[model samples]
Target: MIDTHAHLDFSQYDTDREQVIEECRRNGVQFIINIGVDFQTSKASVDLAEKYDFIYASVGYHPHDAKAMTDSIFEEIAQLATHPKVVAIGEIGLDYYRDMSPRDIQKAAFIRQLQLAERLKKPVVLHIRQAMEPAFEILRRHPGNYGVLHAFPGNAKEAAEGVRMGYLIAFGGPITYPNSQGPQVAASLSLSKIVTETDCPYLTPQQFRGKRNRPDYVRFVIDKLTELFPRYSRDDIVRITSKNAARLFNLPVDDSPELAYMIGKSLYLNLTSRCTNNCYFCPRNSGFHVAGHNLRLNQEPQEKDILTAVERYSGYNEIVFCGIGEPTLRADLMISLAAELKSKKLPIRLNTNGQGNLIAKADLPSKMRGLIDFVSISLNAQDETTYVKICRPQFGAKVFPEILKFAKDCKEYGIVTIFSVVDVPEIDIDACKKIADKMGIPLRIREYASD
Candidate 1:
């Protein structure tokens, strides 16, 4: 994971600085960006980045050091910022709490630095204290400069302002503090605009609150975040935040197309939204995506389009023809791509409303024999009338019996068959499970939750 903010240049780590970094790597801390507060520390931050492969630098002036700024210092910072290791301009902004520098001087220095960062085409890492509104007023003048709000100490309104400006909200030890507003703001905000940091040698988390904070302890910050963001799993938090960090800093990251995405070991292909049935419990009623992926098709994907999406990966457990739509709508494309996909020596699963036989009209079950290893049919309700009421299939009252027949045909043709049902409050769960059991098919119940 990337620790987007830290101050390893401070004198606090003089004796065991190297040892602290070693400990960081051992604890799986991948990258640490050391921030510069002034010219000297900025130079030191650069030296640190050049010395260690895993470390990077950000060159800028801090508010507390604003009084010492000079024309010459700004020129030197400009030169230091040109270093290839430098990723951002900051730990810079207003600090009314300390007033170490005159507020006027702080304002002037902040604006100049903002202008410098804009000229350099680099994002700024903000450092705001008690001067939130004033600082926000300053930031309003500089639009289209995306950055991170380091160690955010603002309320939800302030947080919204930062997000509106396209800035990412960063939290550290303070977020782990008891009764803090950070977690609430984090919960309210989009996960894609959040990042993690340590601000190391300072702002230690609750578990190590009294001691000097290290890069390795960013884990505690992430842990606290998970407790507050219970809706997202730990891996989801990591993947989303890591992607955000990579995007902001131009770090290397992995991505998949919206049309094809991974969940666990399976790669799911969303071809189209054209389905034979419109179930009330279907997630497609609310959105075209699932698990934060945008599955809405711009156009129905062809065989070549699917090949472009799925052929890049090698280790996926299976290629699933599961979308918010009916994969049977493009059964011909599935058949066209089957031989090449089968050559990959990986099993393929198709998820549908089990109306492929009706959609294809001529020997679909037999044609699909060797191509598909498993078929997951959406047999949502138990009886014919209930199925019609829930599914509202275009195939009419005969559709329920046809789905059962399709399942039996798939099983007979040497393919594994499974039935899936969404547990809408009024649906009979036991009854659906019993029907699946009688048909010798496994039942998997899907839970409906708010996005």
Candidate 2:
């Protein structure tokens, strides 16, 4: 895991700083970005980065100390930011909650630092607190800047707005607190735009609350993320968050494609990227990434190649024939793989857009009976017109009734069938739920992500 925000250079770590960093290395922390809140801390952060290869630095003046910032200090910060080890210009922006610095002085410092970051071509680590409106106003004035909303204090809507503006939403220890809005916001946004941090020597995780925070405790943050995103495994969280930090800080990290990826305890197979419908709400519309796994395949895998991929994993609760694309496009391969996987004594599930029978020109549901244990069909809209408008099926509006018929056939064939709909504005979730109810199937409402 990567701790995107930390202040290990502070006095709290003066006694056992080296020991804490060692603990981070032992705890699987691949990288840590030490943040600079003022001139002294910024230089210290750079020194820490120089001392350790895994540690990077972000040099900037915190809003609380904005009043002390002068032209000379700003020039020093600009020069410090040029260091190869300095990855960003951050720990900056407005902080009205503390009111430690005059609001006007804070805004000026924030803008000056933002301009510096923009000129340096580095992402900014925003520190907005109870000043989101003004902070967003400044961000709007400077449209091209992109970075993270560190230790985000805003609601999901505000977080969504930041994401729309090309900034990532960062979560820290406060997310682990009971009755906090962190989980709600985390669940609302896509994991692709989320990154984890510890904000060491400050907001500690619930398990370690009332004590000083450390970079190694980032695992607790990852644990909270796992709970919020049950579809992704702990390792998946590490991989994805590390990738996000690496991208923002331009750190060297491995990010490879996966043919079979696990979510929760289920292993999902990516047999093909070919699909029958082009759903506007689909993540593929924006990118091929889902839960951090790139589902865009250069070549469709055969039965042997899939089995080889599956052999690398173990302890999965079930096998799911699902990817960014429609698995049913490779109906024969899916069935053959399911049959092969039956010996593993694990249940199998198929996530589809309910166009299998139409594509195969056969009773695909009946064909799946006994081989596929559960099926999740996409019931995106309540009626044919809505389906055509949102799904854009290759077979057009005529394919809508056939999708309903397909769900019915799955149930008739004794498969545990479920319907799913993305909660996009174009979709009437209640109406879709009613359709699922009438069909006697459960409806899963997926949160829509504009990113």
**Global lDDT of each candidate:** 0.85, 0.91
Worst 10 residues of 2 by lDDT: 254-263
| Structural similarity to truth (TM-score) of each candidate | 0.66, 0.90
lDDT of 1: 0.85
Question: For candidate 1, which ten residues in a row score worst on lDDT?
Answer: 250-259
Compared to the true structure, candidate 2 yields what TM-score?
Answer: 0.90
- Name model 1 segments beyond 4 Å from true: 254-451
Q: What is the lDDT of residue 416 in candidate 1?
A: 91
* Cα lDDT of model 1 by residue, 1-451, tens digit: 6799999989999999999998898887878889999999999999999999888899989999999989999999999999998989998999999899999999999999989888988889999999999999999988957699999999888887898887999988888888888888887776767899999889999898889999889888878877887766565566667667766876655444366777656788878878888887676785664654657776888778888888665557788988788988788887777766888888899998999988888667788899998899888888889988988999899888888999999999999999998877667889999989998999999765322
**Highest-scoring model, lDDT:** 2
Give the clashing pairs for model 2.
none
Tens-digit lDDT track for model 2 on 1-451? 9999999999999999999999899889999999999999999999999999999999999999999999999999999999999999989999989999999999999999999999999999999999999999999999879999999999999998999888999999999999799999998888888999999999999998999999988899899999988878898888888777788889987555678988778899998888898888787886687776778888888888899999999888899999889998999999999999999999899999999989999999988999999999988888999999988889988898999999999999999999998888888888988888898999998777765
TM-score of 1: 0.66
